[model samples]
Target chain A: DAGITQSPRHKVTETGTPVTLRCHQTENHRYMYWYRQDPGHGLRLIHYSYGVKDTDKGEVSDGYSVSRSKTEDFLLTLESATSSQTSVYFCAVSAGVSTDTQYFGPGTRLTVL
Target chain B: AQSVAQPEDQVNVAEGNPLTVKCTYSVSGNPYLFWYVQYPNRGLQFLLKYITGDNLVKGSYGFEAEFNKSQTSFHLKKPSALVSDSALYFCAVRVLGGNKLTFGTGTQLKVEL
Candidate 1:
């Protein structure tokens, strides 16, 4: 376990509501990533942060946003939840090296109706 | 763009039988391959990775993967399967200097008694 924890392990909300999931790591890793897992789609990266205040979009960045103000915390927000955004969201962290393997959090299951 | 493919939607194997999960990737430069496993309701756990080294790499939980550049494949294999090995397996690829990983759709492994 990479000392990663995700808040709100499960959530259910109506469509068009705002949702924010938090990922906290005690490892102080330099790279943090957010991914959503859905049936038949595996895990798709939502967003990632290389360092404090530096972020980049991933393959499935739409409808989601991320911010990392500190090394140990990364946040993923759904500005307006949609039914299509219902999925298991996982947070991961790495040492930011090419050979390093990323460790994951326990994951949060969000459902939008 | 880097990409990964897992041809099988699911794989079934009996306990004590040899098992393999297929994975293939396409990348521009040298690729960094990875395998992850996710139990029901849990986040993905790192199994092993191939950065640069021998063709075979051992990982957690008595798992190992063979990297074949000729086939552009990094297949996950175990000599004998266990019931606890039943889970969703994912393959991912990242090219040199690329910060994000592209993942496959995932393969569900079912180990039966």
Candidate 2:
């Protein structure tokens, strides 16, 4: 298993509230990614960072934002949480040497009421 | 756009029986295919990948996948199934030179005792 950890294993928040999920990795990987897993949708990329301060939006980046100020931490924030944002969020890190393999964090389950 | 499909939502096999999970992909250029397994309450774990080498690629936990260029399929297979193998399996694909991956809806494999 990779040295990746996600904070707040589970959370329940009301609509219009702000939620933040954190992902930390001890692997010191260069590439980090945030993804959401929902029913009927396997896993969709929300945002990814190739390096510190270098990030890009993904297919489902409409309501989510990510930041990677350092190599060990990647944070995903929901500006104003909505019911549609209820899903399992996952963080992954890749060494870039082999893009084929990515190590993932345990995941965070968020529920919006 | 690159995409992956796992036709079955679930698969069942008794212990000692052979197991197979189907996956097909669509990509413009050469595809980098991968298989991952996820246990309950856990993140995705890398299983195997097909980069540019042999068509038959073996991975962890006695699992192997065959890359068929003509069919654009990378189906995972195991000669003997174990009850411990019961979990959710995901198929993913990345287009050449693309860092992002598109994943399938996932197939839940139930290896019965």
Candidate 3:
């Protein structure tokens, strides 16, 4: 309910294909984060951007990439999808770092076959 | 590096019964702890956070958490349980000057009537 939306709420694509999930926010927050939620793994950070064009890798950013060309949009792209990459992806925005409250979008459930 | 642990994979409680979810954290600096709740098919929602204040932190939806620096734990508790409270709970941690967060594996709360 934080004016955050994720495109393609559900997606199913074959392995080795390219896939992108978009997170758009209207909150004007400075920090945007991408996280993946898997069973038994809770939620792990995939990538995050502090500002436009300033992104950094997270704990689980091995096969994922992110970009923030503008303040409102944060995109998570899978260069070449793999079966292991299938998971529920969530995007969150925070006013600032250091324990600022984070607001999350609904989610994107991705399946790789 | 900062990390949090949720010992229970699942917790069961009867309606009107007191409920508690355990969380312990490890951080290099003063820890900033947070609790989030996730319903099925939805995104994570912030419940409460402990920054630099009283050890007892109260949050939304009749939830409260106690921060114990000696034990490095921040446990979530509610005086009474509700069937609607059934969801997955996550505990996350961040250092004083860190922008990234580390989350626990999540505990599933089943508040049964």
Candidate 4:
């Protein structure tokens, strides 16, 4: 919904291997965010971008990186996967920061062995 | 720092009965509160939001949330529960000056027949 899509809905990779997740939005929103969901932890922000080539760290940005080169795409990368990083990742977009409601993509389930 | 807390891990209600999922938040200045629902294997779906004006905000699927500024609470409620309403619910608060949102762990609602 919300014209959002995530590539590789499910993925499995070994620890120490690089992995990337893609989030695409057709809503032309100005803000995009990446978040990870785990049991008992709800969801934690990984990174966010306010505009192309402008990104910021979230509370749990460690060991992960993100890039937003265009208004429609935001990418999250795991330089080296870890078992602890295994979780369901979600991408969301908003028209603006204040008072704007976020719309989420389906989600990507990633597992690290 | 803005934060949200969902005190209950699980809430059970019978079909046709009223249901409520408690969510309280802490933030400086006025708050922007939101509620989202997640079914198994799906992404979070926006249910409702409270930006300003009336505290009682009605949302999709016959759901409503009340934002209580004095109590610092924004609880999700349904006048009558449906079996289809069983899902994981999350509450979030947006940062005052930023678009970033801080989320609560989540509450699993089970509506049984």
Candidate 5:
């Protein structure tokens, strides 16, 4: 509903392989975030970007990386996928403030065997 | 650091019955609280947020949340339950100046007819 869309809604890949998910927003929000949702962990922040070429690591950024080359697009890449990295990845965008509400994309379910 | 806790793993309510999902948080400064709902395979949808001012915050889909600073809680409530309301609910918190949000493990709501 926030003009956000995630590509490759579902994906499956073998362990030790590389994977990437894309998030696109038409809202032109300045803050973009990537989160992984697991059963016991509601949603853990993986990485976020506040502006073009400006990014920061989140609580669980161990095996993942992110890049925001433009205001409308953010990319999350798994250097080498692992079984433990299998989870639903969600992308969120906000209007550049902590108090502003963040809207989420449809999410991508990734499985690593 | 800011963190949120969803005490119940699941909640059940009959149609037309009042429903509540509990949430508690800990933060170093004034908190920005939020509630999100995820319907299976979909992304998280913003339900409501509490930044300041009124303690009772109303949101989408007939949902409301009360921010109790004394209790450090922001619980999601609905006057009457609907079977379609069954889904996963998540609580999140952000400190006054923090740029990121910390989320709880989530609670599953089961509204039956």
Candidate 6:
């Protein structure tokens, strides 16, 4: 367990409502990532941050947004929740070295109805 | 693009029996492979990774994965299965010069008592 924590371990929200998930890390890693896990999809990268404010979009960044204003926190926000966005969200941190391993947070289970 | 594939959806083994979960990968340059496990309602936990070095990589909880460049495979193996080992396993590969990882659909392992 790398010192990582995700807020709101479980959440249930209505469709079209805004939702936000938080990931906090104790280790000041240079890279942070947000991923969503589904039954058959394993996990899909939603967004990533290289520095405090430098972020990039991932393959599945479409209905999601991320912000990293500080080294310890990375936030993922869903502008308007949809049923398809219902999944387990995980936050991971890496040292930014090539071939480095990532440490994951506990995860947040979100369901949109 | 780097990608991983877990051919089996589920694997069943009795306690004390040897178990294996297959994983294949495709990448342009040398592949950085990883194995992770997820318990029900929990986040993904890092098991092992093959950055560079020996092909036989040992991981946590009596698990090991062999990297075969010729076959583009990194199959996870265990000498003996335990009921506590039952969980979902995922295979992942990171693209060259990129920090993002692509994961497979995942394989569920059931070790019966």
State the fnat of model 5. 0.80
Candidate 1, residue A76: the lDDT equals 99
A69-109 in candidate 3: lDDT tens per residue? Answer: 99999999999999999999999999998879888999999
Query: What is residue B54's positional error in candidate 3, in angstroms?
Result: 0.8
Lowest lDDT 10-residue stretch of candidate 5 chain A:
A94-103
TM-score for all predictions?
0.97, 0.98, 0.98, 0.98, 0.98, 0.98
Q: What is the C-alpha lDDT of each candidate?
A: 0.93, 0.94, 0.94, 0.94, 0.94, 0.93
- For all candidates, state DockQ relative to the true structure: 0.75, 0.67, 0.85, 0.79, 0.85, 0.75
Every candidate's TM-score, chain A alone? 0.98, 0.96, 0.98, 0.98, 0.98, 0.98
Error of 6 at A93 (Å): 0.6
- In candidate 5, stretches whose alpha carbon ends up further than 4 angstroms from where it belongs are none
Residue clash pairs of candidate 1: none
Per-residue lDDT tens digits for candidate 1, residues A13-70, read 9999999999999988999999998888888899999999999998899999999989
Model 1 lDDT, residue A70, Cα: 91
In the range B1-113, model 1's lDDT, one tens digit per residue, is 78899999999999999999999999998999999998987888899999998999999999999999999999999999999999999999887777888899999999999
Tell me each candidate's RMSD, in Å, in order: 0.9, 1.0, 0.8, 0.8, 0.8, 0.9
Evaluated on CA atoms against the true complex, candidate 5 attains a DockQ of 0.85
TM-score of 5: 0.98
Candidate 6 on A53-78: residue-level lDDT in tens?
99999999999999999999999999
Q: Report the C-alpha lDDT of model 2 over A1-113, residue by residue, as the tens digit.
A: 58999999999999999999999999899999999999889999999999999999999999898899999999999999999999999999998833458889999999999
Q: Please, what are the lDDT tens digits per residue for candidate 5 over residues A2-108?
A: 99999999999999999999999998899999999999889999999999999999999998988888899999999999999989999999996669988999999
> What part of the reference interface contacts, as a 0 to 1 fraction, does candidate 2 reproduce?
0.64
The digit string of per-residue lDDT tens for model 5 on B29-104 reads: 8999999999999999999999999999999999999999999999999999999999999999987668888899
lDDT assessment of candidate 3: 0.94
Q: Model 1, residue A60: what's the lDDT?
A: 94
Error of 3 at A85 (Å): 0.4
Q: Record all residue pairs in model 2 with backbone atoms less than 3 Å apart, i.e. clashing.
A: none
Poorest lDDT segment (10 consecutive residues) of candidate 1 chain B? B93-102
